[model samples]
Target: MPEFAISADPIFGTYALWVGTLLAIAGVILFVLGTLLKRDVSQVWLTYRGWLIMIPTLFGTVMLGRTASVLGVAALSVVSFKEFARATGLYKDWWHTCTVYLGIAGLAIATLLPDPTTGANGWHGLFRTMPVYVIALLMIIPVIRNKTDGQLQQVSLSIVGFAYMGWMFGHLGFLANSPHFHGYVAYLIFAVEINDIAAFTFGKAFGKHQLRSNVSPSKTVEGALGALAVAMALPWVLHFSFPHFGTTELILTGLIVGIGGQLGDLTLSFIKRDLGVKDMGQSIPGHGGFLDRVDSLIIVGPLFFHMDRWFHGI
Candidate 1:
């Protein structure tokens, strides 16, 4: 692996410049169109502005170094977990929420530390075992408080929050330690976001059949298929992102982003639908919240991580 420098990988810089240029052009075009038509582009601007900040922050942190990249991802995971906790009412119980936070922090720390056995940058052994320790601590919380009433719900919620939002999502951060850190992380994030946009575009254009009316009313089968088609073609289009990926790996990568990404989104949708909440929180203007924005990554991270690790030992 090359040293973690801003220009260590030309692909990274290329993507940053490309995405920045596209965002700039899109923003200007949208503004001009809105002005010409005398229409309200507030919502569109809000989303565009969010992307403007997020794109740079992402590129800057990842380019800083492996440590910075890992920490940035860990921070995002913590915020995401906070949103989940708040949405599920687990935030009211400081004991449960705090323990999960500690667990997430531990996962981040483990990712930062070198593997004791092989002296590798990240200790995969300890990182994978963190949930066991976290769950055990969550179970011990009730005993320490000497309260059994309502402990089950709190404990269950805490466990789910930490396991799903923290550790699983933290897999993306762990990938920073991989040899192809820049390519892998950047490709996954970019591909997943494009998958989201493709779904919305296709849905609006030719959507007549609802995918799951109960979970996400606006989602359509046509949109889902269109997103899948785009995702499946992305690997070939941007094969530079993973030049090492052969035919099988490329196919699997597409499937993971296409199917796994939507699954992650729907999983959060399931939670929101069950809780009867439209949005998780109002943290972001047009994005709803951190959890809402990163819901697609929750499942995709772990699935891609394991797949890459299994095939290439990354």
Candidate 2:
């Protein structure tokens, strides 16, 4: 039998039971809700709510391990970058779209390949290969361009779109490979979800001052504080429950991750406002799109990665 089966903590067993129950319940509810309502739920609600269910479920199933989680993250990056490119009106050529997708596919495959035994250098080899793929696409842009007006604008947008959505999200693999993978992933999810939940609950109850009506009308100062409070409180709770994370460390991690999560939300909102769209896409019934759900994670992952490295000596 596997060692995990005989572990005293029953970590896997307990997690499976709870996760299965929740997913079954959620699946039924979503099905019923969709049928009864006969109308799709808000994208924001669907995206966040789905992740609230899916992330933990995946974690419990052992599918949320470093390798699997990073692959999921990379897949999301591809979707988001594709949407972003379309929104920004970049890559008019079919060839350009194909090229970008090909590069993304290559990166995704690289993620699933067995980790090289050459230590850090092996990882570096993977990273180096990604740029070469990207460069190949970049090199072909000139060949595809048909001397259209504002050529520079199109190329610039394409580059920025890829870098922001693809390159940045690819860093998830790097973070997953870090020493503090467990802590970092946990902290990232906790911070992002807690902050969003706290903000919404607080804003609804006692949001007198608007934070940004232009971008996100519902955001408020009260909600922001509420988020910060919960963000700060999580560390203390973790300390008491786990006894492994220290008080000072938790507090600092909470503050950084919480603030970063909020900023990410705001940034995404700004993008939506500029595009004059309500949600990113309709992939998830109530949720807008995968990008909408993982917007905060995009920022939180990198921030938490570096912070964990600094504090936990990872």
- TM-score attained by model 1: 0.97
Best by lDDT: 1
lDDT digits (tens) for residues 23-68 of candidate 2: 6786667666677776574553465476676666656433345556
Tell me the whole-model lDDT of each prediction, alpha carbons only: 0.90, 0.65
The candidate scoring highest on TM-score is: 1
Minimum summed lDDT over a 10-residue window in model 2 is located at 1-10
Off by over 4 Å in 1: 1-3
Q: lDDT of candidate 1? A: 0.90
List where candidate 2 sits over 4 angstroms from the true fold: 1-57, 60-65, 102-118, 121-140, 143-148, 239-248, 312-314
Per-residue lDDT of candidate 1, residues 1-314 (tens digit) = 44567676877877887898999899889888788877888888888888888889889898887888888988888888888888888889998888988998999999988999998889999999999999999999999999999999999989999999889998998998898889888899999999999999999999999999988999999999999999999999999988889999999999999999999999999999998888888887877988998899989999999999999887
TM-score of each: 0.97, 0.75
lDDT for 125 (candidate 1): 95
